[model samples]
Target: MSEQNQDKHQQRQQKVKQKVDERIAAAQKEQGIFQVITGNGKGKSTSGFGTVARAVGHGMKAAVCQFIKGTWECGERNLLEKAGVEFVIMNTGFTWETQNKESDTVAAQVTWQEAKRMLKDESINLVMLDEITYMITYGYIDLDDVLEAVSSRPAMQSVIITGRGAHRKLTDLADTVSEVRNVKHAFDAGIKAQKGFDY
Candidate 1:
């Protein structure tokens, strides 16, 4: 009975390997990818930072623009800036903290101007637009303007956009889209955000 089970497992493995090999062989093209990470889960921004780390490992230049999060020091911002990544932290804090619509709109516009420059720069290999979805969702910035700038960027420059409630158009334009579903969270259980783990 054991011998029979082993033979069946080997056969299944061989079939799976063949299918995987075929897919690998078919995928021969490479180009800059637009990636979107969004959802209620905690890892949206973290996932974007992972790509920044990947770009750094490859010695590729990267630019990161933080839209609605500033005011306080962020671990990724400090590390990436120290590692020579072009980093911009734009607001005084989240929207709720600022409590000013007009001012927040202005800040969003200014931050996007810098982001647009980074996107267009051919020398930059990757650009991470952190928490940009909120700006779009709240009508702080024009979606068309953002789309125009992004679509006109260098052909080989990758872009990673992370936040909750991503724009539908942005998701459609992205080559890769991932939604981090929340099954459980430490914050929900009354645990505070931990250093180096939550940040």
Candidate 2:
């Protein structure tokens, strides 16, 4: 690169750094955040679990409440459980596969009980509610109940709710909301879900 081009690049980077430093200096709030990962794409739960793992890596207590994922093995769960993260799985399989509304509702309610307990416990630094939006959409769990529990959680407790089609109120209440858009997926190409990649 020419010297003039290099000087221009350095000036641009200095301005960018100044803006970033100013923003960092202006922000003073310190509290756990409520994050929602929702969309019609893959990796929503994967992203949530990544945050749980990050918290665990920091020696923070974490818990997971899996709503729609039944008794299937989960790679993230297998690893996080060994790291001392608590898990409360519904173990009812997917709703379409179960095909039993009454039983599914009972299981969802029972699982929610554990979730509520974890949410109330101040010791747990992070809580991941995996695929829970489906329960609210299916009316197996009440949205207001979930909202109440989340809103009333300890001030320093972070929460991650992951699933497709998140409710508006949940998004509104979240400090951070990320929607993953699906441009394409291998599953649509008749490619089966690969182990350690899809799961």
Candidate 3:
């Protein structure tokens, strides 16, 4: 081949390689393994549920294990269940709301165990651990266990951990972390938590 033609060929190959590199970088940015939604505000679970919806929309399998606030009828649970999202509710109301620490702790532990199983399932593309911070804060489950699961899930699997008072360690392990700050809520304005809106 002529030297000039050889140079042109090399340039074309370089351009193609650059394009491939760019595409791979974009794909990696879109893929993530760990996420946390936390703060004193509401919508932590709602944010997690939104991810669940997105995952389900893409036909990805998902699992949700809600720790506290499980007994109440949740609209997300109802809708997602019908859509083939596996859900395991702890069935223990809020510890403060229930005024039963022991029972709540036991329930949280049980739910965490189930979540751990779901996290290890290679078939599950996404796992949402709703209200998981309470389990860590109350010592119902070891923070190390949570960290290990977040770190060791399938390379492409994503996990969403949601609750207020998220520990610093959890945040450190998260690839994406968001805090939902509550500026104001209708409940503070004498509006009850409506069935569909709040519950």
The TM-score measured for candidate 2 stands at 0.98
Candidate 3 residues lying further than 4 Å off, grouped into runs, are 1-32
- lDDT for each candidate structure: 0.90, 0.95, 0.89
Report the C-alpha lDDT of model 2 over 1-199, residue by residue, as the tens digit: 9999999999999999999999999988988799999999899999999999999999999999999875788999999999999999999988999899999999999999999999999999999999999999999999999999999999999999999999999999999999999999999999999989988
Collision pairs in model 3: none
How does candidate 1 fare on TM-score? Answer: 0.94
Off by over 4 Å in 2: none
Please give, for residues 14-98, the per-residue lDDT of candidate 3 as tens digits. 9999999998888755554799999988788988999999999999999999988788999999999999999999997778787
- What is model 3's C-alpha RMSD? 7.9
After the best TM-score superposition of candidate 2, give how far the Cα of residue 156 lies from its true spot, in angstroms: 0.5
**Ten contiguous residues with the weakest lDDT in model 3:** 24-33
* TM-scores for candidates 1 onward, in order: 0.94, 0.98, 0.84
Sort by lDDT, best first: what order? 2, 1, 3
The lDDT, on a scale of 0 to 1, for candidate 3 is: 0.89
Better of 1 and 3 by TM-score: 1
lDDT of candidate 1 over 42-151, digit per residue (tens): 89998999899989989999999999767766888879888999887785689998899999989998898899989989999999999999999989889998888788
